[model samples]
Target: MRIDCPHCGLRSNEEFTIKGEVPKARPDAEAGQDAYVDYVYIDKNTRGRNVEHWHHSGGCRAWLVVERNTITHEIYSVIDVQEAQ
Candidate 1:
C-alpha cells in the first residue's frame, strides 16, 4: 500500500513507520503503578477508522495523521500532523 505524504508525494508504506496510537494521556510522576503500566504497555486494538501517526522516514521525514480501516487496510485520509491541528 502507498501513503500519500503531503511533503513527499505518494510513497510506499515501507517508507513510513507506524508510531502506534496517539498518546491520549501521560501518566503523572505521582500516578500509581497500574496507571503507568497501562500507559506504557496497553494497546486499544480498535477496529475501523482508527487514528494513528506515521513517520515518513524515506522522504521529507515529516509526520502524518493517517485515518485507516484496520480490517480492510484501506486508508481514508492522510494529513500532515501540524496541519491536522
Candidate 2:
C-alpha cells in the first residue's frame, strides 16, 4: 500500500510508521478504574471511518493525520499533524 505524505508525496507504506487510532480521550490517573482501563487498554475498533496518525520516517519525517476506512483501507484524506491539531 502507498500513503501520500503531503511533504513527501506518494510513498510505500513501509516509509511511514503507523501510530494506531487517534485518541478520543485520556483518563486522569485518579479516574475510576474502569474508565482508566478503557482509556488505556480498550479499542472500540470502529468498523468504518477512522482517523490515524502516521509519521513519514523514511521520507520527510513529518507527522500526518489520515482519514481512512477500517475495512476497505481506502484513504479519504491526509493532512499534516500541524494542520490537524
Candidate 3:
C-alpha cells in the first residue's frame, strides 16, 4: 500500500507507523472505572472505513490522520495532524 504524505508525497506503507484507530473521547473523571477501562483496553475493531493515526516516521516524520478502509486497505485521504485539527 502507498500513502501520499502531505509533505513527503507518495511512499510505501512501510515508511509509516500505524497507531490503530483514532480514539473516542475520553471519559470524564466521574464517568467511572468501567468506562475508562473500555476506552483504554478495548479495540472497536471497526470493519469498514475508519480514521486512524499514522506517523510518517521514515519521511517527513510528521503525525497524520489517515482515512481508509480496514478491510480493503484503501486510503481515501491523508492529512497532517495539525491540519486535521
Off by over 4 Å in 1: 27-30
Q: Cα lDDT of all candidates, in order?
A: 0.88, 0.87, 0.94
| Backbone clashes counted, model 2 | 0
**Candidate 3 accuracy as TM-score:** 0.95
Among these predictions, the greatest lDDT belongs to 3
What lDDT score is found at residue 51 in candidate 2? Answer: 93
**lDDT string, candidate 2, 1-85, tens digits:** 7888888788898999988788768887788899987887787788999998888989899989998888988999999999987
Error of 2 at 10 (Å): 1.3
Score candidate 1 by lDDT. 0.88
lDDT of 3 by residue, 5-85 (tens): 999899999999999888889999999999999999998889989999999999989999999998999999999999987
Model 3 pairs whose backbones collide: none
Model 1 C-alpha lDDT per residue in residues 2-71, reported as the tens digit of each score: 9989888888999999997766689889999999889989979789879899999878889899989888
Q: Model 3, 1: alpha-carbon shift in Å?
A: 0.6
Better of 1 and 2 by TM-score: 2
